[model samples]
Target: MCLRGKQRAGRVQSRVHVDTVDPLSAVSDGVYRLDREWRFTYVNAAAAALLARRVEDMVGQRALDCFPEVAGTVIEAEYRAVFADGRDRVFTYFHAPQGRWFEIRAFADPDGLTAFIRDVDDHHRSDQRRADRVAQLTAVLEALPQATVLLDGDGRIVSANRRWTETGEVIRDAGLRPGVIGDSYLEVLSQHLTAEDRRIIGAGIGGLVTGGPRAADPPFVHDYAHAMGSQRAYFRLQAARVEPSGQVVVTHTDITERVRDQQALAWRAAHDDLTELPNRARLLELVGEALGRDPGRGALLLLGLDGFKAVNDSLGHEVGDELLRQVGARLREQVRPCDVVGRLGGDQFLVLARGCDAAEAAALAFRLRTALTRPFCAEGIPVPLTASIGVAAAQPGGDGVHQLLSDADTAAAAAKGAGRDQVHVFSPGLREAARWRLEVANRLRDGAVDELVVHYQPLVRVDTGEPEGVEALLRWQHPERGLLSPAAFLSVAEETGQLIPITRWLLGETTRQAAEWAAGGLPLRMSVNISARHFSAETLVHDVRVALHDSGLAPENLVLELTETSVAEDPTRAEDQLSLLQNSGVVVAIDDFGTGWSSLAQLLALPIGTLKIDRSLLTAAARLAAGGSGSVLTAIVSLARTIGIRSVAEGVETPAHLQMVREAGCELAQGYLLARPMPAADVPRWASRVRAAGGDSCALALRGRAH
Candidate 1:
């Protein structure tokens, strides 16, 4: 087929001769043949489909004229050059008008030029997808908190994040600046890491790049601490192997705070918060360690402070805390360098002296007592202090820390009993004393009500010698021993918390006996001693009302006497309690009034009806009365009178004592002379006999003033 183009009206015209072999019509790829004039002489089916046109209409048309978009473009220029040099040209071009990529080959033929075209759009899209994937991965690495480094399979640094660049400069002084691309990271980092860190990191990196048997597990981690700027920082390095590509990625993260928190927790576990000394657990641990090292060369000393509770109650807990801190400091100063001082608890301390014998421990204890005896004046308040120290020598592989501490505690109790501010060595007798105390505490808890009884001591009128009232005293009838006084077992009862129930039983029993006496025509006022523990009880008012209701006794007939110390504890709270009792018609008396540090303001604030002079004060007043002074007693009585309270003098055994009470203007007297405390059963008979013999008034009330 021959196609010719003729010029007509400045436009190209084309003619075709369909006599030649049509080679372009047999191919699957697109085909079109154009003469020198650029007219289409033949167009195959594929080319027609590619151009979306008819073969008959394109056969005589000019190729550039048929598609004006490619008239002056590179695609058209290359096609013209193929006809000019008679050279075969192959090229790929994007047809923007059709939005497709085309690969074409132009061959110079004897009849005309032929061009072959194929669509290459899929290959172009695959290359664009690969570039997009690379950009996405780069963005993710840049946003991470940890400084990250990526290495190739050959162990050379291939890429790094922005954080890696910043950290590399900061840590460069430590010889760890290996962030540049195409550098050996392992070689650069070897100078900074220790031999052990080097080994761990080397194994991890080798496992990643060499693709060993660590493909299933997670990344390897390494931790180290380094000083950065002014503070030390901790970091963890994690080396992971990327999947499909045997490359290594290392990340560094700071963990300084986590490490510091762990250290602080460990320190707090072994120390006391108040004194900053080693606590009981830590002290025992240290003592056991010392004993283990030298079995017979160590001694333990335990100190119990006297009157610490009074300071805590009177001043304040804040002042009490400051006192304890000062005490700890003083203890540290008194001990040797090898010794350890620690607070066991409130008002109790323990010292473990290494290389010390009993004598040395005793000496140290004495020195400590002397040091503590000086008034602690912290917080600007002078507080007198004393310590009872107990020393126990190590038994050379015989006893543990617990036994040693327990023995020391027993000896300390003995020291306190012998009047505190002294030191005592552990002895066999102290153990027996401790055991007896334990037994007493247990028995008191079990059978306090059944084994205990109240005895009545009559209080007589100082003028007429008439029996006006009786004071109830607690006596324990032990099954083994004879009757026991309060001084024998009351301390143990209070220490073991058994005094509360015991006091309740006493109140109920005394009220019942007083009601019985009144029913039998022997009416007298009943005075019961109440402890500070009972007086401070929230149920104190309720307990008293219950007792009176249950015993059928009038409130006015019962008198509750409290010690001066008990009344001084939390005076405001004590006033509230005392007011409740007084409003119920119960008389409140301050027993042993002059023995405590009660201020005049405190005494006036408390709602009280009577004041009982202690035996010591009365004895002193009696001796002074012999000299015709009697000023102290007169002042006390006059104060009582001014405050609308009656005065009662205790321990009036001698005629001189009786004479002094009458001279001092005291209203009542109680002593062995008036009536020794007797059983509740014997009180009635004693009162009846004294009344029948007309001696009750003569025995109790003075017939006339002492001359």
Candidate 2:
């Protein structure tokens, strides 16, 4: 390492002025300061913290008093050497009280001397791992034909391989020396370097030179030439920035050949083996990144081939692949480079556009829609496919990756919701709703006991309409704003892993309530909605059983509701767990049916006795009945009947809604049209209303619906 032209003669040796500030104070790597009397003058935060003593208490404390055993031996010699040399010294020592080994950082100071100690007992393997990684990097760098060198911030050569030396290059500076005492990198550079190189190196000399703030995500690359190597070599510098030290340690690798390898690897990783465009992984990564960051008033659109499934089903995947390629090319050409274009596995694709005013995002979406609409002749057939695009945008600091993707997904569902070949941009109301949802998520993570509460909505038989079960719904009675529904908190619950404890709490309380109900002759079934994140663990089931057992209730009385996506993530585990519950006499229901990824085939195969038609569909069915069109209601009713699984409509809010259920042929309608979730103490009284006229049941349902 060397620096060339700088004069050191007149430069004040500030490094020697330790003053009242202990030398250890400047050394973060575990340092200690000793006085003239061989007593401790200072200890760095690291050393003080490690020794479990305050810096104030350690200062002026005699060595023997601090550690009686180190009186005249290794510790004494260690302190003396630092004072004598006036330079840094390293040594290893066993610290019995700490029960560990240490690598000490020692140097002389104005007061006397200072030392930094690090507990390296557990670092042997870590050091080896680092060494092995460095060796691997060296091998990789050496194989490249391009010259490479890693330059320290001081403009000294930190690492230079054979390729770097072979290239004709060097830096000359003012003063020069080899193994010179008190010499610095400036000494070497001053001896040999060009004028231009000197200016480039000296650009930051008068300013505080530190790496910029840490990048949230890493694997960033910096491209430049190694001053030691005159050849135009593209070196990729990977830096690990340690904020506390204000230092960025960079590893240089010759990337001329490696870039080709990188492209090859990227192609392999992000392209389909059969049809190479962008794989699901690449699409998700790009989309996830786009979605994750503050897109700054940008829009995200998820475009799916409207009739892709039909294409694959009718024609072979080969024809489908060709069709996909043509479609991909058109989509690629449809957007500007500023927008991210990616294929999200199968026929799913996404576009992320920044600075694209809403109108522009809409315009781009239309172009993509038109490009996709073109008919492609495949497998002796003209296969026509359109797209359903869902668009969502960030509002100020409103959107992160999760929310954007979700909104896009929801918007896409809206496009699909409104027939395909259309694009749907998320409405302001939806974004506001999402914002509220995020608020709930934050509350869930912070252990917001204030807002947390559980409400139970009663479930009844279809014909008898008797309250047979109670579905627990979580409500956040926010202080600033009134009560909020699970829709606000559920997504947050799923995201922050609060769902587990929340589910556990819900299960435990439901068990207690159910036991009380049974004891009081109500004996209603206790049902709880399950989140996808929770099913991965056996703990939830164990918790349910514990709650049941603790509450003196039978496991047979518990009913767990799972939406399609929840089961899809881990169907085998779900099946096994649901079997455990069902075999114990409990019931399992697939909630929010007709709204998720799974099909009727999976639905029938699943171990469930009930299916809750999504509220949108049920509401649509009910609306049709209210409008005197019995046709749609009748058909939905027929579908439910044909499936053999009991159909439950979740948002029945009126008498007409209930009547529609009876007319449509669905079994149960739970809503504000039914009894709302009530306190456990009020349940027995409410349960008495089975024969208490439909209005009583209706009142409770409205309360739940209101929530």
Candidate 3:
């Protein structure tokens, strides 16, 4: 037993009398006693071991002098307090010199103080590590750019970083800056989100809480968009449940730019750069989608602009580009809200109208045509434009997008052929015609002139029935169609811009034939037709010169006949070309005079050598053949005479027509009455027969006049 000074005498007397065991010596904990004089009177084995001393060494030692390491520490202060106040206290302190922690309990009696101490370094180090971990985690959370929030199990916001608070302000309701700490996140969601969105967010958040089977384990993520005031943002939310504590760590990332970039890419892929309209690829895709959803519930109109190339060639491509943009806008105005207008490249556009039948489509096409026909003012120039529309109804039979577009294109070509500014619907006959045209266009482009043949028809002097010259006519000997006239493919040649080459071939072949006729003593002048396109050809004069030189044929023996409208279209250029040809001794005649819109002044200005009266005048004269009122014919003949040019009356099929033309003083007459257009080999025989007959059956009547 340990005692204070007051009990020292009694204890010493008792100790001197009785032999009692010391109970403090048998305890496991460090136990020690201090007297009121600050001296240790008792020391147990555990206490001496903790102090790294023997029990005998510590006994009877002053407490402060025994353990100098405890001086001025919480352990010493608590020990002194216990001694002074007769109380009990427990405290822990770290001993820096020994790198250890001491947990001590001091109990004081009336006379002295008793102390129990143990080493607690492990617990102290563990607490220090925990504090360091908390500091590191806080630093990481504060440094993150993404909005980060930590929530408790009850969905209460435990903590939020600056980024989280700032992002919240951006998306928060006006005038609401509620404190994030201790606020219920679930309540915020319920207040601000729509019903559907709230449900979704609630589900995601709920899955992060409670640690239930349905709760997501970790890395739960989702996307949501929000609009606050004028600001719109898209956020990607990611959450994870903290282990052991059941806390949730949620992060929100602003992905607005990514979303917008994706949308922009999609839009650019589906539109045309020049016209700002849906391009061919996108149009087909949309049409395919519509067909997939509702088969045959739409009609497609394929429109081709007429005279677009002229505008491009005359005004320049920049103006043409502006014109296309304006045309797209105009087409948009003409269509219904649900209809689609798209560019199919280069003067072609397509319209998709849902639930429109053939009749409705036709009406709509006409309206669109009218819309396009209105002059487009571009670059301060007004360009008159027209469109040929091909309408194709979506039949219940289920047409493919490609097939629909192809058929619509076919109909559009037919519209262009039937005369532009017209609308044509797709029909079996139209498809057949389009197929034939496609064949002709392909052949023309490939320069397939093998089927072409030149035939000659004799032009006879009206007074003698003697052949004056032979007009060379183009004939197409189709393997299947036998013989086709110029009407079969002349327009196609003109459209394909192949007429220049065809005309060159005609000039060369006729010159050669005239040379052959001259060699055979037939000596007939060769009249070959020329298309209007030849006048514009820069190489026309060179080609004619080469043909005459190569064939050794006299230029005076060749007459080039063209429609009057050809020259009237561009009088200045036409006059220049005619002067060049006439200066070269090549006769220039208006092939179908009196049938064109050429004025008398224009005709007088032309360097023409002959005026070939069209067959229409002959029909008119035949109607008045009985009265012999050849006034119109006489006026045409007089015009030719006044202009110092020969007059040829064409299409005379009977004696009355011939006699009428003769009375009208026409110098030359040619038609089936003289001879049908024959092969070059047959022309010589026919001219020979006319020369041998001395008088043709009609010539007999002219014999009296000759007499």
Ranking by lDDT: 1, 3, 2
Q: Total clashing residue pairs per candidate?
A: 6, 37, 0
Best by TM-score: 3
lDDT: the better of candidates 1 and 3? 1
| True-vs-predicted CA distance for residue 156, candidate 1, Å | 30
Score every model by TM-score: 0.58, 0.45, 0.73
lDDT of 2 by residue, 1-707 (tens): 11122524322232223233554455557766677787764556677777777655565568678787766767778777777777777787777786777787677778787676777878865666655755665676577665544334454444545665543233222122332212233444333445654464343321223445443135344454434334443455454432332323334466666666776997899877655666666765765665456445678788888767767876888899988777777787888887767676788777878776567788888888987777877666787888899887766666466667788877886687588899988886765665776677777777775467778888776566667788888887888887878766666676667878888887877788788778877788877888777677677567767887889988778888998888986788888887777777777888887678776676677778777877777777656666887657567557656766777878776766776677667777687666667766677777665556553454445455567
Task: For each candidate in turn, give its C-alpha RMSD to the true structure in angstroms.
Answer: 12.7, 27.8, 7.3
Quote the positional error of residue 144 for candidate 2 in Å: 30
* Model 2 weakest 10-residue run by lDDT: 172-181
Q: In lDDT terms, which candidate is top?
A: 1
Model 1: residues with Cα > 4 Å off, grouped in runs: 1-276, 289-297, 304-330, 369-389, 395-400, 411-429, 628-631, 695-707
Residue 546 displacement (Å), model 2: 2.7
Tens-place lDDT per residue, model 1, 126-240, is 6566446435555766888888777778988877889988878887765445458888878866656668878887887777788877652687888866555466777788888
- Residues 399-429, model 3: lDDT tens digits: 5999888889989988997879999999877
| lDDT minimum window of 10 residues, candidate 3 | 10-19
Residue 684, candidate 2: alpha-carbon lDDT:
76
What TM-score does model 2 achieve against the real structure?
Answer: 0.45
Clashing pairs in 3: none
